[model samples]
Target: MIPKLPGLGPLAALLLAAALSAWLGIAGPISIEGLYRWQNLLAAFAALAAAAIAYTAAMAKVKLDRQISDEQLMRRSLAILLKVEFAIQVLRQEARELEEKLGDWKNKSFKTVDLAISEPKEILEAWETLDLFPGDLILALRTLRASLVLYRTDLAKFDSQVEWESTTLASIKANPTSRASVAAKLLIQQSTDTITALRATITRLTNLLNRA
Candidate 1:
């Protein structure tokens, strides 16, 4: 329902006064000078009442508009946070898959390299967009991003050190003393370390976000 304007009672009173003044001017035994003075006074008061009502209504509209804008911003922030939360879970799943692949790294078909060398942006980007209502989530986001970046650096180094020819996997199994086998072992360790670090970071972050 539309709210009644402020000072409705006073506006009604002014209208009643004007009507009474007009009646007095037409029917009552009042002097022209007195009636003119009274009408002028009522006119001035009416104008003031209108101004006051207009100002009040304007202020109310401004306040309502501000409230709506704030609500929109909060919804957007929350949506971003939820997306980041889901992305974090995806990271955990991806890390688990990497762990499984590392155990079977000797297989030619298994993948140990090709991991992205860049930091994950879901957390950091969402952190930038959020209002940080929980506030401590900020630290969690920063820590996670830093850990991922550091791990990616090592992963990238491991990926670069080896030449992934078809003989790479066969040599690791047949001639375990070759340079390719040693490089593959180092990559297995690196991949393991990265997954462990990421699991720890994700654990801490999950506790913060879900309060679990």
Candidate 2:
């Protein structure tokens, strides 16, 4: 069975008042002038009551709509945060893999040491679309984006160096005694350190998102 609605007692009272006013106008013993005045007064009161009820109903509707809108926004934020967290995990894994690859740089050239990482396009897009509520989470996201951009910039520079090294150091061959070999080793060490730092950043971001 449908639940009875609340706040309808006043409506019933208003209807009863209207019915009584009509009856009084027709059959009450008061003078004609007094009866007319009473009717007019009742009519005015009823109109004011109706206006009040309508205004109350409209306010209730607006409140309900705002509640529904807030819920939708919160759900959307959570969904996007989950996706971004997953992407951060992927980035963490890639950072580890790149670190491992760096260890074998003795056998591979900078060209072969390709970290094979790319921008987290989906995460970035979701971040742009969402407005996370928690202040800490928002700050964490900002830091994460900044870290990602810095990492990418570093990678780009590494790639540019690799290209130049490939052409300039081609004749050098990077033998054990060559200065080029030592420089390559240093680059490998630097790349490993960068990957470690990137992994740490991912971990921090993941923790922040998890808290959310």
lDDT (0 to 1) per candidate: 0.54, 0.54
lDDT of 2 by residue, 1-212 (tens): 98965554476566767777777687776686766767876776677777767877888899999877866665666566556666656665665555554444453544523533565775577667745535555555555566556544544444333422222243333321122333334434443443344345446545545564
The parts of candidate 1 lying over 4 Å away from their true place are 1-32, 103-121, 130-134, 159-212
How well does model 2 score by local distance difference test?
A: 0.54
Note the residue pairs that clash in candidate 1.
none
Q: Kindly list the per-residue Cα lDDT of model 1 for residues 115-199, writing each as its tens digit.
A: 3323446666775764543445555566566666655544444434443433334444332223333443444444444445445
TM values, all candidates:
0.55, 0.58
Score candidate 1 by TM-score against the native: 0.55
Off by over 4 Å in 2: 1-33, 104-109, 159-212
